[model samples]
Target: MSTVSTHVLDTALGRPAQGVPVRLSWITDDEVVVLGTGSTDDDGRVTELAPDGLEFGTYQLWFGVAAYAITSGQSIFFPEVTVTFQINDERHYHVPLLLSPFAYSTYRGS
Candidate 1:
C-alpha cells in the first residue's frame, strides 16, 4: 500500500501556509470518494491524508486557498487548487504545494 502526505508554502510571504483546509480523495470511474480531511498545521503540513495507506489508483488533493486567503487577508485569483496524481507503487508520496496569489506549483516530493 502507498501513503500520502502534503505541505503548503506561500511563496509570496515565504512562509508555511497555516490553517489551510485540505482534502484527500480517491477517484473512480464515476465518482470521487473522500478519504480524509484536515487543515494544515503551524508548519503547513498535513502528514496523514490516508493513515492506513492506499491502493494503486488515482487520487486528488484539494486545497482551500479561498478560505486561507480570507483569513490571511491576501487576494487570491485561484480560490482552490486541485492536484490529481496516480499512485502505482507502495512508496511514500509527498506532494508539496508552492503557492502565491496568482500562481501555484506542485511536485512529487521525497
Candidate 2:
C-alpha cells in the first residue's frame, strides 16, 4: 500500500496556503473516482490525502485556487490546478506545490 500527501506554499505571500481546498481522485480506465477531499491546515499541508491507501496507477490532485485568491485579494489566471501523477510502488508520495497568483509549480518530494 502506498500513501500520498501534499503541501502548498504561496510564493507571493511567502507563507503556507492555509484553508485551500484539495481533492484526490483515482483515474481508472472508464472513470474517475474520488478518494478524499480536504483543506490545507495552517501549515499548508494535507498530510494524508489517501487515508485508505493508494494503489499503483494514475491519480490526480486538484487544488482550488479561486477561493484562496479571493481571500488574498489577488487576481489569478488559473482558478484551479490539477496535477496528475503515477504511483508505482509502496513508498510514500509527497507532491508539493509552489504557487503564486498567476503561476504554479509542482514536484515530487520525500
Candidate 3:
C-alpha cells in the first residue's frame, strides 16, 4: 500500500506551523482521476493521507499558512503553497515544508 504525510516547520518562528489547514487533492480533473484531502495537526504534520492507499497518479497539496501567520502577527507574502508530485509506487511519501512568511520550501521527505 502507498501512503502520504507532511510536516510543516515555520522557519521564521523556529517551531511547527500549528493549526494550519492543509489539503491534498488533484489540482485538476486532468491531473488525476480521484480526490483526497487532509489537515495539519499541532505537530505541524498530516499523519495520514490515502487511508485506502495510493496508486500511480499526479497529486497536488493545498497548504494554507495564512491563518497561522496572521495570528502570529506575521505577514504571509504567499498566502498558500501548493505542491504537485507524482506517486510512482507503493511507498510512503513524506512531503515536508520548511516555511517562513515570505519564503517556503518543500521536498520529498521520508
Candidate 4:
C-alpha cells in the first residue's frame, strides 16, 4: 500500500503556509472520490493525508489557497491548486508545493 503527504511553502513570504486547507482524492475513469481532508499545520505540513493505505492508481491533492491569501493579506490569483499524480508502488509520496500569489510549482518529494 502507498501513503501520501504534503507541504506548502509561501514563496512570496519565504515561509511555510499554515492553515491551508487540503484534500486527497482518488481518481477513476468515471469519477473522483475524496479520501481525506485536512489543513496544514503550523509547520505547513500535512504529515499524512492518507493514514490508511492507498492502491496503485491516480490521485489528486487539492489545496485551498484563498484562506491563506485572506489570512496573509496577499492578493492571490489562484484560489485553488490541484495536483494529479500516479502511485504505482508501495511507497511514500511527498508532494510539496512552492506557491506565490501568481504562480505555483510542485514536484515529487521524498
Per-residue alpha-carbon lDDT of candidate 1 for residues 1-110, written as tens digits (9 for 90 to 100)? 99999999999999999999999999999999999999999999999988999999999999999998997899999999999999999999999999999999999999
Considering lDDT, where higher is better, how would the candidates rank from best to worst?
Answer: 1, 4, 2, 3
Better of 2 and 3 by lDDT: 2
Candidate 1 vs candidate 2: the lDDT winner is: 1
- TM-score-sorted candidate list, best first: 1, 4, 2, 3
Model 4, 1-110: lDDT tens per residue?
A: 99999999999999999999999999999999999999999999998788899999999999999999999999999999999999999999999999999999999999
- For candidate 2, report its TM-score: 0.97
RMSD of model 2 against the true structure: 0.7
Worst 10 residues of 1 by lDDT: 64-73
lDDT of each: 0.96, 0.93, 0.80, 0.96
C-alpha RMSD of candidate 4: 0.7
Model 3 Cα shift for residue 13 (angstroms) = 0.8
Model 4: weakest 10-residue lDDT segment is: 45-54
Candidate 4 lDDT score at position 10: 98
Model 2, span 6-84: residue lDDT tens:
9999999999998889999999999999999999999999997788799899999999998888887889889999999
Best by lDDT: 1
By lDDT, is 1 or 3 better?
A: 1
lDDT of 3: 0.80
lDDT agreement of model 1 with the native: 0.96
The prediction achieving the highest TM-score against the true structure is 1
Q: What TM-score do all the candidates reach, one by one?
A: 0.98, 0.97, 0.88, 0.97
